[model samples]
Target: MSEIPSTDEALANLSMPLLDAMMTQRAIRRVKPDPVDDAIVVKCIELALRAPTGSNGQNWEFIVVKDQRVKDQLGKRYRQPWSIYGALGRRQAANDASMLKILKAVEWQVEHFSEIPVLVIPCLRGGTRVPYVPTPFVGETSYFGSIYPSVQNLLLAARAMGLGASLITMPLWNVTSARKILGLPLSVTPICVVPLGWPRGRYGPTTRKPVQEVVHLDQYGNRGLTP
Candidate 1:
C-alpha cells in the first residue's frame, strides 16, 4: 500500500487516528476534465485486488474507458435510468428538500457523466470457472458479493490517489445495451459504470447515519458500539 500512490492529504493522514482515506471518502460526481494517467488507474486496481472475492476466484475485470465517442455512447445509455429513477425519487422524497438535493446532484452527474476523464466498468465473468467449483447458484443479489467488495476498494484507492470517483450502476440497469456499447462479450457482465476524475471541489468526510443506528450486536436492535 505504501508503494501505491497518494495525495498530500493521504500522506498527512499517516498520523490520523482512523484511516484518513476511509474517514474522508466521498462519492464524488462532479469532477474536472484532467486526464488520469494510465499507471494511476492500474495502481488503483492493484489495491482493489486486495478485497476478497467469492470462493477465492478472481474472475473480475475493470474496463477502463477514455475515448470520447465511446463515453458519449455509454453516457447516453446511462441517462435513461437516471431519468426514470430521478422521477421516482422526486415523487418519493417530495416532502424532503435534502432528498431533492440528492436527486439534483444525480441529475448533474448524468448530464456530465461522459465528461469525466475516465469511465471504468467493473465486470464479473459469467458462467463456469473451469476446475474451480463455485458457490451454488443463488439469486442475482447473492451473486454480486464477489465484485462489489473490490468496487469499494477501488473507490478508496482512487480517493487516496486524489482522484474523484463515483459508482454509477444506473447504466448497468440496462446491461444488454451497455455491454453492446462497450463491445463486451456476452459472458462478461458489466456490473457498474464508474466515472473517475480529479474532483471539482475539496475532498471531505461523508455525512452518514451513525453506526449504532445501523449495527445490531448479539440481538436485533441492540447497539453495541458508541460512536
Candidate 2:
C-alpha cells in the first residue's frame, strides 16, 4: 500500500494551491468546451454556503443555468444594456485612448458571454423595491453586507477548484425581464450572474494600485502612514 501523507505535509500541499489560486485569479470571459460536472458545481456551492452571512441568516440562493434555451434567452436580454454601454463608451473614447481600450474589451466579453458552459445566478432574499425615504447608510450596508461576502467566497472557491469565472451585471439593469425569465419570486432579487467554466488560458497576476496609495492613516488624505 502507498504511504499516507502526514498531517503537516497534507496541510502544506493544500496551502500552496490556495495561495496560487489567490494570486492568479482574473476575470476570464473566454472558456473551453470542457464541461464542469454537476458534482463539482455542487461542491462549489457547498463551499460558498460556508461563508458568513448577516445574523447567520444564510439567505442567499444560487440558480445554475445549464439549458441552452434559457442561456439563449439570457444572452438576448444581456445585449440591451451592453449595446447602450458600448455606445456611451464609444462616445467617451473619442477623448481618451484608455477608454477606447476598455470599451473594446467589454464589447468582446459581451459577445462571448452566452457561450460559457454554466451561468450561476446569485440571488438575495429581499424585495427589489427600496424605500423612497432616506435610510441610514449603515442599514443599507448591513443589508448587502450579508450576501456580498458569499458571492466573493464563491468566486474564490471556483478559482481554487481550477475553474474560471467572471462576475457580470449587465443583464441585471433590466430587472423586469431578468426576473421574468428566471421565474424569480417577488422576495428574491438577482444580484449578479457568474459565468463559469474551464479556462482557455492561464491567468497572470492581477495589477492594482499599490496599497500605500489607497490606504491612509486615521484620517482621510493623511499619507504619512504610506510605506
Candidate 1 achieves a global lDDT of 0.79
For each candidate, the alpha-carbon lDDT, in order, equals 0.79, 0.75
TM-score of each model, in listed order:
0.83, 0.84
- TM-score (C-alpha, index-matched) for candidate 1: 0.83
User: Candidate 2 regions off by >4 Å?
Assistant: 1-16, 90-102, 127-133
Q: Count the backbone clashes (under 3 Å) in each candidate.
A: 0, 0
140-175 per-residue lDDT for model 1 (tens digits): 555588889999988888776777788878877777
Q: In candidate 2, where is summed lDDT lowest over 10 consecutive residues?
A: 1-10
Give the clashing residue pairs of candidate 1, or none.
none
lDDT of 2 by residue, 1-227 (tens): 11223333422333446667777777766676456777667766777788898789888989998888778888887888888878987987798886686576567667776677898898888743467967678867876787778777777777766666778888778878888989998788788898887777556687677888898899999888845
Off by over 4 Å in 1: 1-18, 128-142, 223-227
